[model samples]
Target: MRVRYLGPPAQAPDPLDGRYVFEAGREYVVLELHAESDGSTLLRIEPSRGSLAGLYNSRYFEQVSDVIPSLWGVVTLPGGGVLLGPPKWLSGEFWELMMEREPEAEAEFEAVRDEITAEDPVARSS
Candidate 1:
């Protein structure tokens, strides 16, 4: 998913290593969104450079799109089995993976996706 950096997380100081990572107001493609225990989420943006690394706090970005990060999430397929996505998807690639791996269930998967909704962080600002 895409997101635009807002700055350091609202609840924290600037990351000591951010100079090598995020650029203020820059848009980034998130590599993953990790579900957090505190009802918050963590993001892994495609690295700005190879020198620094760490999952970023989601509070630092305004969502460019919807992304639901939950380890407990479950999607029932048309078949009798369940589709299990990792608690946190890599580059938020779960949907693609599901469609690719379950061609026969494409319509079913999409139907499920359409039935879900997440509050867009960016929209909340407006």
Candidate 2:
């Protein structure tokens, strides 16, 4: 998936986490998306900038293509993460954690999305 960094949060940066020094308007490839039961979400991205590759809250960027194809089940992800998705949209902290922990995250996500779309042409929203 693709996303564009909107810049750091409006308020002061967190004292602990600091701030995300992302280039505003720059586009990044979303390696993985993770959501929380509380409705919070994080995105794993390979930025177009320096070595800031890591997980950042979804509030940091805007989904370029929000669609996440449905289908798939208890899949294995790195960092000991698990995801039961698509129905949950494009956010699942477990999924993004899995994506970062696993080297083949983007490929795996593509495969699942493709497989689901192949079966059901109409799926999740963007």
Candidate 3:
């Protein structure tokens, strides 16, 4: 998937938020993106036609590449799997990363985080 900034640059009070569009396969979807307090980003995807009503999709972008400080997020497909994306995304390229990441679905993600911390607490803490 290819993502590009859509609207104007971020301003004060909410410099982390940006309007972006992503080409998913053959469809281009609009998304309102906001950098979480924690280092992650929140993507509120606009529902498409014939999509499930009263249910909007949300995706979280986490820091995956450390060498250059990039973010990678995954969105669960309507079918079953997920689509991993935002590869090569950098702060300088698009937007800056916030200091604290958001705590959405913390309980769900905590499980995997526990395993990561258990394996390497020092690295995880950093």
For all predictions, the C-alpha RMSD in Å is: 10.7, 8.3, 16.2
Candidate 1 overall Cα lDDT vs. reference? 0.50
Which should have the higher lDDT, number 1 or number 3? 1
Model 1 lDDT tens row, 16-122: 32444678888765544555545556665545432222467677678776555333244443534343333333325544655465553444433332233123344
User: Which candidate tops lDDT?
Assistant: 2
Descending-lDDT candidate ranking: 2, 1, 3
Better of 2 and 3 by lDDT: 2
Clashing pairs in 1: 31-91
Better of 1 and 2 by lDDT: 2
**Residue 75 C-alpha lDDT in model 2:** 40
lDDT of 3: 0.31
Per-candidate TM-score against the hidden true structure: 0.44, 0.48, 0.21
lDDT (10s digit) by residue, model 2, range 1-126: 567777766787852121555678876555456665566666655454333345677776777765444453334446454443443324556356544655465555555545544543232332
